[model samples]
Target: MISGNKRTERFRDAVAGFEAAVRAQDADRSQQYFDDLRRYFGEADDQDFRQAGPRLAAILDEMPAAPRATVAVLVGACVERGADPTPCAPYVLAGLAGALDDARAFCDRWAATGGGDFPDPQAEEPPEDLLDRVDPDLAVAWLTLHHWEMAAVALLDHAAVRTALDDGTRTRLLRTLRSVEEDSGYVFKCLAYALLVLDDEPLVVLDRPTGTGYALRMTGIGDNFQLHTLLADVLIGGGHLPGRAPSAEEAAVCRDRPGQVDTIGSFNLVTPLGDWVWNEGTPSDIPVVDGVRLLVLDPPSYQRSWPAGRFFPHMKGDLVLERVLGADEARRLLAGCAAADG
Candidate 1:
């Protein structure tokens, strides 16, 4: 076992090296330092690093104060390198708590510098019994952290519900989102919300006319992170109702709908507006008609390796559609439609 002092020295050196490489704009060097940092945390093995959570947490606690973004980057880097910090869920949670505290502090400092009254930033305390509720394995912890990180963003912004973030931070957060793309719809929604909040321009939500009902869509220059979250919130908050599940009747009706419906797999149907899945084997090509409006969730990528049917399970009378396209794809599709309309 490594001595505490030795571990501390290793962490500090690794952090310093990473920072230096970033400053030098040496992508290769920065990545090398990141690898070193991961190795220091016992992620040298191909196995998920979640087993090393305790060690990783101890090292983080020993470090001197660092910037909120820096902390996010470090943790993110570990995640990117496949180090599962789940076993150290408590430590990861604590780290998140610390980062939130740091964000509040930074905001306060900024307020003071501007001579403005400090906004009573909300304090988000991670659930004390998180470990009790979640497994301490790396995958579980990764999912848990993924959930909390997005929640932290909302809490930090006081559930701004409409606040935007700096471009740099937005990009960094999106990169992190990309890493967790294969996780679940819940993770994707959180990432989308983060991107929406970080965008520098105005966004509009559009609803596609499907038969008599409508499906909501978001149009923007960059990632439509907000739109995805909005869709998720709508689906979740709408109670995943039994009526929402596409039925054989609806599928037949959808076939004649505006967009062509291609069955991607046993469970899913890819439509122009959005993808849909059904518990029954019969696939439907449904268009977003009425009753669908984009409402901000106020919450909230990757080639899926799993088969479509197994990937999205029917949950309590509802089916989940993972993101079929990224922001750029959505834009291109919409742009082509607009051109044709013109």
Candidate 2:
């Protein structure tokens, strides 16, 4: 029993650490945590780990996503090494599918803007009544983010990624031929970068400097962490940048409602899923090699987040921060700008 308790403690820690890495959007941290998990896996016998599979799966699913990319690789490795993960098979597979869906969505969303193409800084109209479903601010954020992603995808597909690859390599990194044939293929890097950037959304901004504030160079809008929070956690923090974060009293007035940022100390229970399930556990199945392939996206093609260079040298990064305005107000603003230029 003591042994089991110790294992559980360590396992939970490892899982928590991995999830934290993912949320932090640091590949190196994620890899290191995964390595810790692998070491822990070896500490116990195959049957021992297998018995805990369901628990692990439940934990992983509790989070906003499952770390499918890592779990899939771990499962494959265990199988190859003659370890039986049967007890945990169902859980692992569940996490794998969920993680893959999130990854695919994340990547496909942003990769559309890859290569030398640029995201249109200008905002566009939403589909009919889109604002009714979500706040005007959130609606605009989604449109802008989606546009940038589309531009990225175009940049990636335009020979920059394909210049040096056997068909197999390209397929693995981009899509299997079958998927492309069926119009179902998606880029691995797309999923990877999506998660990375989104993880970087909820920043811990202290008044005092801490290892350089969340400049969020890659994203547009100086101090634009709020938009990412809306996307990643599906709730914006309570406060506007030009002003202080919302006060507890102010937040109390607006709590439990959509279309508003949350209070700083507010309970995270009001997440998109209506509860706090974050950091319970996360799984990833993307192999180290695939992660390496995503290195090209490390640098912000448009902003200054990474110390790395742009994936598309020909493309230039421009800040694309969101600004809210009514239809008439927008027209007036544009007209004013045009006149000023003239």
Candidate 3:
């Protein structure tokens, strides 16, 4: 039986050999190298192999220097294993930069060999220009991972409406969306809200009155006001009325009628309130008083300028809280109106 150190050394050698074969474009050798790796890593289900899987850094060290090709391989591997690629992004980015440089070099060589008929491929093509030559769907796949919205939009624009995405590409895109969604909390909902506006999806007022302005609010998750603000901006950017940014009237109302708007939306973070209101009964049992059609509740534990007494009643009893309001009073007031309308 191989000692751990010996096994690790063997793995490293196999990885180096595999990468070299890939660089040389020797298919038979590459296949053999991969077969060795697979066997060493063990037949997928081997307990020892699973427990002793190589670190990401080790795997990255063994990958070919060609960025694009290596990224493709890594992405393919991730899809095959049903794993997220986020942990590997830094490595992927490094590889992509190398691949892009290699592409430039290859273009230069091609033009030189073609005796000046070919355009100088080394010229820094506008991202738009690059979009023209590469598969637009693949470009979108990569750009999406980086949250390069403008590039992704442009790439998707170039893609044929009927173009089919490869399974790997589709999975990567979904993973990217999920990552962005998780990072930005309500961003996906904001985007959906924006698309709804575009599709003429009628916004219904929540239980609140039509003239009442409402905002979606969440408890602060760290110093992450920027994420919340960005989400709100995305919703407004979608060209909808009563946008995420409070209009003058809405702002004025929040300032004048502080009692009507409940600030703080989500309970994801550990606020001074200690813990979240997990049981629906805590929120549902609260009575909704008249004049305030929408009552905003803070986590019962949060001690702030907004007294818990004002909103807690609305959350109790059979009343089901339809929408969450953010900690920003102005925004919550606005989103409450928006939710009601939707």
Note the Cα lDDT for every prediction shown. Answer: 0.35, 0.33, 0.32
Per-residue alpha-carbon lDDT of model 1 for 159-276, expressed as tens digits?
A: 1222333456545545545443422222344334434432122222322221111233332211121122223334433443111222333232222222222221111222343432
- Could you give candidate 2's per-residue lDDT for residues 1-342 as a string of tens digits? 468668756755665677677566667877777677776865555554454443333344333221343354444344333334344444443443333333344334444434222223243543554434444433333333333233233322222222322344333533422232133232334423322221112222111111111212122111122222322222223222222233433332222222333323311211211122222211111112212110000111122111122222222222222332344533432232211110
Question: Would you give me the overall lDDT of model 2?
Answer: 0.33
Judged by lDDT, which candidate is best? Answer: 1
lDDT of 3: 0.32
TM per prediction: 0.29, 0.24, 0.26
Candidate 2 ranges with C-alpha deviation above 4 Å: 1-39, 64-68, 75-87, 111-342
All candidates in order of lDDT, best leading: 1, 2, 3
Report the error of model 2 at residue 1, Å. Answer: 24
For candidate 3, what is the TM-score? 0.26
- Residue 111 lDDT (model 1): 36
Q: What digit string (tens of lDDT, one per residue) describes model 3 on residues 149-198?
A: 22122222211210222445444444544443443232332212111111
| Residue pairs with backbone overlap in model 1 | 49-84, 50-84, 192-225, 210-288, 210-289, 213-289, 213-290, 214-289, 214-290, 215-288
| Candidate 3 regions with alpha-carbon error over 4 angstroms | 42-342
**Each model's RMSD to truth, in Å?**
18.9, 21.5, 19.3
Candidate 2, poorest ten consecutive residues by summed lDDT: 292-301
